[model samples]
Target chain A: MTITGKNKNKAVVESVAQIIFTVCASFAILAVASITLYMILSGTPAIFKVGLKEILFGTVWKPTAAEPKFGILYVILTSVVGTMLAILIGVPVGILTAVFLAEVADKRIARIVKPAVELLAGIPSVIYGLLGIYLLNPLMYKLELKIFAGSTTHQFTGGANLLSAVLVLAIMILPTVINISETSIRAVPPSIKAASLALGASHIQTIFRSILPAAKSGIVTAIVLGVGRAIGEAMAITLVSGSSVNAPLPFNSVRFLTTAIVSEMGYSQGTHRQMLFTIGLVLFVFIMLINIALTKILKKGAAEDGE
Target chain B: MGNDTLYQKRKRPGEAFLMAAIYGAASIAVLLLLGIIGYVFFKGFRVLNPAFLTTVTSSLKGTVGIAGNLLNTLYIIAITLLIATPIGVGGAIYLNEYAKPGKLVNLIEFTTETLSGIPSVIFGLFGMVFFGNVLGLGYSLLNGSLTLTLMVLPLIVRNTQEALRTVPDSYRSGALGMGATKWYMIRTILLPSAKPGILTGVILAVGRIVGESAALLFTAGSARILPKLGTNLVENLSRIGGKILQPGGTLTIELYLQMQNGEYEVAFGIGCVLLVIVLLINLLLKVITGNARKYGKQ
Candidate 1:
């Protein structure tokens, strides 16, 4: 065949290959979209039957008993409170660590700390739960805490409680906050720091006043991402949250949304399954709302930076 | 003047104390990671034996090995990588090379980001409904692999696309100028150049697949026995050919199940093993990519 004819044939083949690849890529996206649609559509009928008030506001969660109530307020509250607790404990420590890596520490120290944080990120949640059970629970007991205080008569044992869940979550999310905060702090202009130092401000003062403020948005994004992760975490929470559906009252044990879905899905029949899907949908909406809020904050921050 | 100097020096001491406290907090965070790993290793070492790696649970004694679980994890990894890697790379190539900036590409991007954000439990639900119920594959390795394929497809695509994007345009122009077709140029030039990125994606995907428990919970039913070798190979090949469905267990699921049953030592040991595998792969990829960059610069 002529060279021109061969080139034309190759172009046709290339076009065909491109079309095939696009179809496959598009199909993957469609599959995920369809999953979301299927859950929403299938779950809506149950939501309507139960009424949104009972599903969202009711306190009880007895799906297996003769009388079944599918309220998720308690679960949602547990997830929120647990995540907040994690953030409270993790954020300060993470910020300090970020500062240490970014400003206080030398490159060698930063290198060691950075990979250690990444390694922490890679540790499976199940292992975290196990560590909490073996170590944190015992430590809590040693401190005369009520971690194992009410366990004798309870369905579950020691080591599985809200505090334990929150502690583990704090550990799990530390890497995220530290990494992002460090990056943001590093991005602060060197001139700003030099100027602050030239004006007789100490390194610590300059970091807090200039660098921290400059990197505020990134730090906030890191915290938000950590919250998203903590709220959505399942296995760790399941293994630690005592798997109790009772309303979480301070030190009392509780269950989160993800835990409720995993623990109950095995035996959840009829409305129960739908309710679980509804819980997932609720979680999805919450994350999406947070993500949208985060995006808005980031855009505003960008605008301010531009100005 | 002496008194004022003394006051200033006292304030500096307090500042140094505060800095020490701040540094201490940061060090504690790093120490927490080391403490966790150390705790796991110390506890797990008691159970790290050949039998732990070789035997399958045969009786109610619960002292059995995780041989079957190990096999199942390997099988799932092989099947998932075989299915996901090529398609992920192909989709990425299309996105980087052929597709223009348009609605479809934007949709693809959105879908990938959303998929990455959705909780694993949701993926579990999707896998349960789609693979377990709709496809009628039942609870099998095929279903689990497919679920994971869906879960990691976006990640692999994004990574591969980024990798492909980083390849200089000059290479493409050079190839085209030599009268090479786009297909030939992509296959021989771009893909090879982006191999390290593709491998890094594969490594990350492997880490995820190895660690995934929630999605596999519904798709790959809690089977505790290893398939016979012949059957295993057949099933493996069929999965590669996109044909078979067999229920299997992964390392994460095994660890989860074991921990739930209070097999603490076993779970920790397996966790250590899994962590080692992941770290090894990550280090290997780092080394490979480091070398690739060095050579590329030359």
Candidate 2:
């Protein structure tokens, strides 16, 4: 093809347009990256000034008090324990649901179940929080789990404890696990099932031994994604976590890094505010590491599957 | 025959138990939806009177309507769609129509994917620094809308690209063969074909915008009353460059604030309203896409 003047000009314009779009998209990524960088860079000095042991191990979070301590061990524990609890509750149910959708359910039932999961995913966290406040809180009180030890007043009522946050987080992450697990299970080759069946294996045996084994890495990725979501979740945890900065015991009402950021960002100023940024930075690093790890694992899984 | 009998014996109870468990877990997903809808309606219905829809929230008990917040949510959706749809669609077109697979396109794809992964709270923080402080837009609807625009742009671009890619290449080739220019072929052949997908993207974006709480908390500062049509629009626009830049409280924010203040009844009521709106939008998308499919089949 001959390069005419008109064609050359058009090529120039198209290249320019592509460059501009690429830059715009790059800016969006940079926006997120810059936020993470700013949080870490600005927050580290405080972390250093306060000492890592004081920041991570100290019990108190009194950033504004005369003896300002910024220990985050409790918050970190709350997040990790809450996420673990969520995974414990959510993973089995989600895996079962995915197995059912992939292996047993009729097409008509699968269709209904699929969209229901989508709707579940789409329901906003605010509504989840509202439900927790109205339904879960009262239920906890009625179960006598709200009262601490022998207290009769039920004033504590476990209004926002590790249990409630974990339960909510479990529900929030369910769709993530279910969707991914279902897709992975469906991707398992029918030939594997056929071979197992030929060997006189039952459908159940085939699924557990042959199909699930093949989809294991994908299933792991799904669980990791769920953990990431549970760790980063804010609004639902905020409403249900009770937002107390006091070092959280297992039954005590507590705050995660996210809930702390949301609850304190409005009123906090000075170093107190910067510390909140530090908290955010902590959460950001935590989630970013999870995301990158998941991505790498997923890529390797894909490569292995391709082989 | 003996082997088959043995396999059947081994499989029957185990398969039955596993299948039952799977079905039980699947049913819970449906039950969760029912639980959410039922709880919201049960609590919210007690306070969902006509006054709640028509009047602004007041200091008086039993009169705290969400009319203003509803309007604010609507305004944010409108402004965000206005800003996001064009740019998002345009970017998608540039990717699909003009660009070849190169470093730039790959970079854009990577960036958009990463953007989608960032948590909303981070977006809130960025909005605070960039829009609120640096840009001097302060906490206003325009700032919130802009922040949301960035948040949803990747969704729009990805969806639009998928839609455009789904359009058969033959259509474009035929249009070009008929002496149509590249731009004309795209305008006439590609976009129209991808209309349903683009609209689906818009619907999804609206759902995110309406349900968003954290990002807007910083950008669109809390204001109880709806802005008036004339001076308010002007003042808001001038403040944020003729955009929706007033201190607006969306339903999500109102719901959060109400729950925070221990107004369970009102929060539930607002929650129901938001749920209904989202459901309706979803239903609209289904109907529209259903019709489009029907028409295409015809």
Candidate 3:
């Protein structure tokens, strides 16, 4: 076709449209960059002022005491243990459920169970909080009373403690684990299962030996995502945990990194406020680490699949 | 029994045990949902009344209700979607149709995933700093919606991308062969087909915004009152605009507050309302996705 004035106009419009689209696409990058920059800007000043050791190692977190101390050692430990424990409880049940959905369940059962799982996933975190408060906390308090009967550990804040938080986290992370794990489990090559079964392996053996082993990377990713979910959980945790910065004993009222920020951000000012941002920064670092590890696992999985 | 077991159909104890565990685990997931939903509906049923649904909390009249919170939640969902959908759709178009495989494209995709992974609390904190204070929107519906816009952007983008991907390449080729421009092909063909998926994404985003609380806590000050409005038509329209700038607590935030204030009755009621809303959302999603699947086959 011959180049003409109208054609030039069309060419210019296309390029301009492309530019606008590119800018639109870059918004995600812009958002991530700004979040990181702001986090560093707002979070680092507190770290420098408080000394990283004092903040991370200091056990006393009396932010509003006569002489305020801003240690988050207990806070860090609570998050670490809470996340780990939740992972332990959630992963098994979640993986087994995935196996059922992917390998065992009939179509009718899967159809019924699938929507329920999605609804569970859809339930608000705060509703989880409500459940924790009413259902789990009371049961925990009764258990605590029995276990610590005649002991001088005054059970304050009812049953809101580390254990309750963990249970809540476990339940909350279920949807993530089950969905991702199930998808990966289904993606396992049918040939692998067939081969294993043909080699005189039982059906259960084929699933455990061939299917799960093949789907390990996706399962691992699901677990990592679950950890991320548990670690950064705020609303359900804030309501469930006893909101005090304590060592993460099973029954102690404790605070996770995310809850520390949410509980204090409302009224906190100056250094107290900035330290809350520091907690966010700490939480951010943990999530980034998790994200990095996930990338490594996924890349390795892909490379292995290639081989 | 030993040699025949290898070739014969035999069940190991381990197999039975593993099978039991799988069934049991699936049951737990189902039970948890049933238990929570059942509990909320049971508790909230006692407290829910027509009056409870229709009025705001007024100390002078001594009426406590979630009307204000319900409205605020509706408003936030509307405003957030308004801001997020166009940008998200545009971004997805760029990703799926226009952009070549390159560093920038990969970076965008990675960031989108990261955004989804990032917790709401961080978004709340960032919103409190940037949008709430520095941007001078303060703790208002608009400010909260902006924060939520970021939170739900990934949903829209990913869903739109999936929808766009499902569109056959032949449509694009045919359009271009007919001398249509790239933008024309996308506008006339890709987007219309992608509408169902985009709608699904929007519905999902709505569900998220309805459920979200942590992000709104600091960014949107939890003021549980109806915003002021004008009486006359001209003034009423202007006042609706004014409502956008006022601080309002959504249903979830108000639920948290009620829980804090030891108002279990109200809290349970709010949770029940939220559950019902969630049920409705899931139903909508099921309908759209089922329709999309049916359409896909044809």
Evaluate all candidate structures by whole-model CA lDDT and list the values in order.
0.81, 0.82, 0.91
Clash pairs, candidate 3, are none
The residue-by-residue lDDT of candidate 3 on B135-176, one tens digit each, is 999999999999999989999999999999999999999999
Compare the candidates by TM-score and give the number of the best one.
Answer: 3
Candidate 1 residue pairs in backbone clash: B140-B246, B140-B247, B141-B246
| C-alpha lDDT of residue A28 in model 1 | 67
Residue A191 shift from truth in candidate 3, angstroms:
0.7
- lDDT, candidate 3, at B56: 92
Cα lDDT of model 2 by residue, B1-298, tens digit: 5687534654477678887888889888889988888878888888898989878977765467888888888889998999889878888887888778998776677667666766788778778877788789998888999889888998899889989988888999899899766766777888899998899899999988988998888789778685445567667656444436568889999999999999898899998898888788778877977987897787
Model 1, B1-298: lDDT tens per residue? Answer: 5677634743677668769977897789888978988887787777778988887877776666788788788778888899988888888887899888998887777677667767788778777888788889888888888888888887789889989988999999999999888888998999999988898888888888877888888788777675444558767766544423667677788888888898787788888787777678768877978987898799
Whose lDDT is higher: candidate 1's or candidate 3's? Answer: 3
| Candidate 1 residue-wise lDDT, A48-78, digit = tens | 9799999999998887779988888999888
C-alpha lDDT of residue B5 in model 2: 58
Q: What is the lDDT of residue A187 in candidate 2?
A: 92
lDDT string, candidate 3, A102-186, tens digits: 9999999999998898899999999999889888999999998888888875656589999999999999999999999999999
